[model samples]
Target: MKNLILLHGALGHSSNFEPYESFLSQHFNVHKVLFHGHGGSEIPAAGLSIELYVEQLQQYLEQQELNDIYVFGYSMGGYVAMCHALQYPGKITSILTLATKLNWTIEGAAKEVKMLEPELIESKVPRYAAQLMTLHGENHWKQLLPAIATLMTRLAVKPLLTQTQYESLNLPVQMMVGDKDAMVSIDETLFATKNIPNANFAVLPDTKHPIEMARPELLIGLMKDFWKI
Candidate 1:
């Protein structure tokens, strides 16, 4: 079986991919990565950043002796996966990204960052706050929010991948977004797909921003079709 890595989004735990893992494991040697500061993992002293995550991913790949791996990344994880492919070409055979935000601008990031405020989340969406605490660890979830906000701010300032860089990618890529996704726009996803020489784009119907809201059967079917497995 081919190796497959499932990457979760920011503030997301590896366990979030559990719904899809069991089915995917039958076809591939599935692996789920938990970035630092997530899922009870220790936060780096320098905090969470795209560069850090990519480096960690490289280490994971090396340690596991994985080669020509296939990746399915959700949201921020998708961005990191692309960066990893760019930084270390040929390591990943192909990629499938869902709801991954491609256009990072100062204005847009600021708007998104506003929604990540811990205080606001606790006050306005206590249930979500509690869920995050449970997912990331009761004590660590608060710190993770700010760290992720900083990461987003930095990404807006200096995006890891450029249009030209996207065009230069050698591996096949499939960019996908939910029709109802509020965070990532279809326009941006299409733009990325057009730039990448060997890339395609798709929009899931009735899908929302949250992975938990995604239709697992639909996503699994799409993955199998895209990966041809």
Candidate 2:
């Protein structure tokens, strides 16, 4: 059986993959990873950059003595997974991403924030604060804005991958985005998959950026099939 390493989106813990855990366990050994600062893991708040996250993932894999695993990442987790595959092409067998964003342009930033606003506005302040706490603990509310700001403002340092980088990947790569994903454009997702030499791109109908609620089974099935577990 294949070993599947699952990654969750920002501010989300490994439990986010709870629904698929049992099903995936039946087919493959599953490890639902908890990113630093989430799930009571000891990681700093400010060092939550993409590179840091990638390093943490590598360490985790080493500690667990894992190899030849398939990776399934959602949203921000997807970004990490893509970078991982790019950096360590030989380690990954197959990669699958759901609602992953590739490039970040000036216009893309506007659209990204615009899409997030509605969720922030409609959300209950305390509930949202609690969710932040889940990821950042006691200083959740106070640190939320700064953390988000850092993600937006500091993103320029991390340039988007070129077409050559994506096509250079030797393993199969698959990306899925919800048709109704307000946070990321379908065109953006399409553009990402296009350059990948061994890539399959799919759109889930009536789905959203936070696809946890829309179609968990579809996500699970895609991973299982792609990994052939």
Candidate 3:
């Protein structure tokens, strides 16, 4: 059986996989990747980029001597998975991504960037703000917000997974999103799959963004059904 690697969304940690850990481990060696600026790893000043996450993943694999793995990524993590699989092919057997917004137009970036407003986070959503501070540290979380904002701007200009790049993938790629997810449109995912030679697309019923937090088992079931494992 191939080892399973779970990649969490931005502003999230490896613990995000806690709910699915036991069940997933029963079938495959489960590895949770805590990207740079996350977990115990040192935060980089270069900010958040697919390159940063991919480098961390590559290091983890090299350190563990791992190969023939299955990758499951959420949101930003999902984007990272596609980038990684494309950049370094042989090690990854398959990839499954959820809520990974495909199209990154400048307009889309502006809307999402506003949500990272430090003032809003500190005032209206204090609890959420405190959690981030605790998880990422006061100074680092402050730095992280802007870094991610910059990353969004960068992605708008150059998406990590482009049509030409995705079409080149030789491995199975499954892209899914919640039907109710306002952040990512079904059309974008459908369009992405069209160019991906070995890709498939799906929209989960009665679900929303952060499906891992809402219905992780549904994701697991989808994985099993698609992989036919």
Most TM-score-accurate candidate: 1
Which segments of candidate 2 are over 4 A away from where they belong?
40-46, 110-127, 134-138
175: Cα error in model 3, Å: 0.8
Per-model TM-score, in order, reads 0.98, 0.85, 0.92
- Cα lDDT of model 3 by residue, 151-221, tens digit: 88889988777788878888898989889988988998888889989888888988888644458677778
Sorted by TM-score (best first), the order is 1, 3, 2
Q: Write the per-residue lDDT of candidate 1 for residues 46-151, one digit (tens) a residue.
A: 9789999999999999999998699999999999999999999999999999999989999999998899988899999999999999998887898898899999
lDDT score, candidate 3, position 163: 83
Where is model 2 poorest over a 10-residue stretch in terms of lDDT? 113-122
Which residue runs does candidate 3 get wrong by more than 4 Å?
none
Q: Give the backbone clash total of model 1.
A: 0
Q: Write the per-residue lDDT of candidate 2 for residues 83-127, one digit (tens) a residue.
A: 887887688788888887677766665555443442463374666
Error of 2 at 203 (Å): 0.3
- lDDT of model 3 at residue 72? 85
Q: What order do candidates take by lDDT, descending?
A: 1, 3, 2
Error of 1 at 62 (Å): 0.5
Of 1 and 2, which scores higher on TM-score? 1
Between which residue pairs do clashes occur in model 2?
none
